[model samples]
Target: MTLTAAQTVAALATIAGSDNVVGDPAKMGAWLYEPRKRFHQSAAAVVTPPTVEAVQAVLRWANENGTGIIAQGGNTGLVGAQVPLSGNEVILSLARLDRIRSIDTAAGVMTAEAGVILENAHKAAEAEGSMFPLWLASQGSARIGGVLSSNAGGVNVLAYGNARELTMGVEAVLADGRLYRGLNALKKDNTGYDLKDLLVGAEGTLGIITAASLKIYPLPEDYETALVNIASPEAALELFQLMRQRAGARLNAFELIPWIGLDIQMRHGMLDRDPTASASPWYALIELSRMAGTAPGALQSSLEAAFDAALISDATIAESLADRTRMWAFREQMSECQSREGASIKHDVSVPIAAVPALIGQGVTAAETLVPGIRPVPFGHMGDGNIHFNFSMPVGADPKAFMAEFDEAVHAVIYDVVLKLGGSVSAEHGIGQLKVDLLRQVKDPVALDMMRAIKTALDPKGILNPGKMLRSVP
Candidate 1:
């Protein structure tokens, strides 16, 4: 028989501890709501297991009882992956497991508990004279477990990598409560199946990550930062190629921003001053890592070369720490400044690095065709081909009416262009409850079959994150 909400809470509290279980619905908002506020499902209860063994116990009990468990960290996920699908599920929060198990600077790895906050991990690595390079806006609250679960990518992905590439291995509790202790600092262990990759992006359907061995790198001595004005995305692409050729691995970041981003931020007083050289159609916030004893002004000289090649029009190279921070502030505040204007339809999609120009041109044209006067705010990691293609509703249009009418149709139009260009529908952001139906519509049938088979093989009971990523087989 199925247990009621009270019974489920009581059982979980007994297994873990009454003090760790939150049965009251009023207090479960933090775990239930996601960053976007798109999903608002109520969880049956929230359980914060203090130890790995406790997590295992909770999972075993959940599996046997056929209860759905949504493993969560920090609760700062953009997609609804870390939140509840059905109201009957229990949120298995990993917040209490925050700990750095070990840090081997010589090996360039840190074994951190799943609940270790991303910023804290950075501090720990910095304390050891190394750096964990995964830098996200939500790093202050986002945790290791959720970051790896989503395989998050950030601005630094150009120099470092996304969470999966940086992760060495993971220690997790399978749906059946058996611990999969695969954590290691080894660079090469061609063992069976490469299970760590499977779990890292699984969104906790296959397992609940308890700890992970993450690759850390030597700290760069300084960063040469600049904001260059570009004529268009085409020019931006050429400039990006020039940077890669010039800086090679030292090329840290290449972000593309439309002139509207600057206009919006300045209009809303988000920036102290314009960070670019002058008003241009587009901008590129570029940076290069300067190691110890390396010559400075590499980025400045690069801009000079770009000018000679006619890839850029004007530029403002950061002269001090404050200038670099302000330039980055302009790029980072692009998303929030849009909210100040009005509701915007956003897609975290990616295309080939070369086809970025075509993608933006074609996408903007299509969006305008559908909703005339819609403002296109296309920007993101130009180096990595991930553009956060977004559209601000027509000026003075009702935000709710605009989203209600165009959200679905706009997504269809954009996804069509993305697929035609051999691009991905979802890039940095993983498909959570938001894109379940979309994934089914766009994903290959054979890939879906394999995913379902793996889900069944690992979670035969279908008790882990039900109705997420892939729908119920039956």
Candidate 2:
């Protein structure tokens, strides 16, 4: 039988102390409010489990009582994966499980609890003279559990990889309250089904991640950063290939930003001063990491070659640490700068690196056709072909009206083009409640069936993050 709200709270309080159970809605704001502010639903109760055993006990009770448990971390996800969907579900907050279990710099691995903040993980690695390469804008608040759950990809993905690739192993609690002690720093294991892979990007649909063994890297001596002027996306793509050919693995970041980003930032006083070299139609923020023995001037040499080929018009190499920080700030602020304009429609889509120019050109044309005078601000990891396809409403247009009329229609248009080019509709962001219908519409029927089968087999009671990723079987 399904438990009532009172019974659920009482049971959770019994498992993980009364002080840890938040039954009052007013006190649940911090866990309720997501980063995007798009999803708004009340949870039955927010329970913070202080230990892994507490988490297991809560799950055991939830499974037996048919209660929905939504695993939440720092609550910084853009999608609603960490938030509640149905009002009856209980939110299992992992905030109290913060701990850096161990750091083995010699082995290039760090084992950290799910509740450890991303920034704190970075500090721990740095303290050992190593580095956890996963870097995101929300690193200050985004916890390791949510990061690994979503398999987050940030700017450094070009050099290092996404969270899935960076993670070596994970220890998660299964739906039936059994502990899967799969944590190991093993570099290579001819393991059976690769359960770690399943849980890393599962978004808590399968199990609750307790801790993870993450791959860390030696600290780079320094980074050579620059902002180059490119005429268009096509030129930026060519420049990326050239940098890769020249610098190889040292080419850490190659980000694309349209001139509109600079304009919006300056208009809103988001930047102290312009970080680019004169005016240009587009900019590519490129960086190369230098090791201790490696020589500098690699970026300058590459830029000279780029200039020789006319792949770039002009560029400004960062002269100091302040300059490098400002250049990255411009790229990082791309998402935030859009709100200053008005309501914006956003898509995190990806296509082949060679087909990026076509994706942007055709996408922009289609968006303009749908809404006349729509301002297109397409920018992101050009090296990886994942562009943050976004469009601001026309000047003087009503934000609410624009979104009401064009949100769904605009998404349809963009996804059509993305699929046509063999791209993904949701690149970095996983399918939460927001894109459930979209996944149903675009995902392969066979793949959907497999996902549903897996969901059912793992979470037979549907008590673990119900109504997320795959729809409920029933």
lDDT of candidate 2 over 1-474, digit per residue (tens): 667788888988999999999999889999999978999899999999999999999999988888889999899888799888988899998888899999998999999999999999999998998989999999999999999999999999999999999999999999999999999999889869889999998999999999999999999999999999999999998999999999999998899999999999999999999999989999999999898899999999999999999999999999999999999999999999999999999999999999999999999999999999899999999989899999999999999999999988988899999999999988898888888888999999999898888888889989899888887775
Error of 2 at 325 (Å): 1.1
- As for candidate 1, its clashing pairs are none
Residue 169 error for model 1, in Å?
Answer: 0.4
Whole-model lDDT for model 1 versus the true structure?
A: 0.93
| Error in Å for residue 417 of model 1 | 0.4
Per-residue lDDT for 320-422 in model 1, tens only? 9999999999988888889998899999999999999999999999999999999999999999999999999999999999999999999989999999999
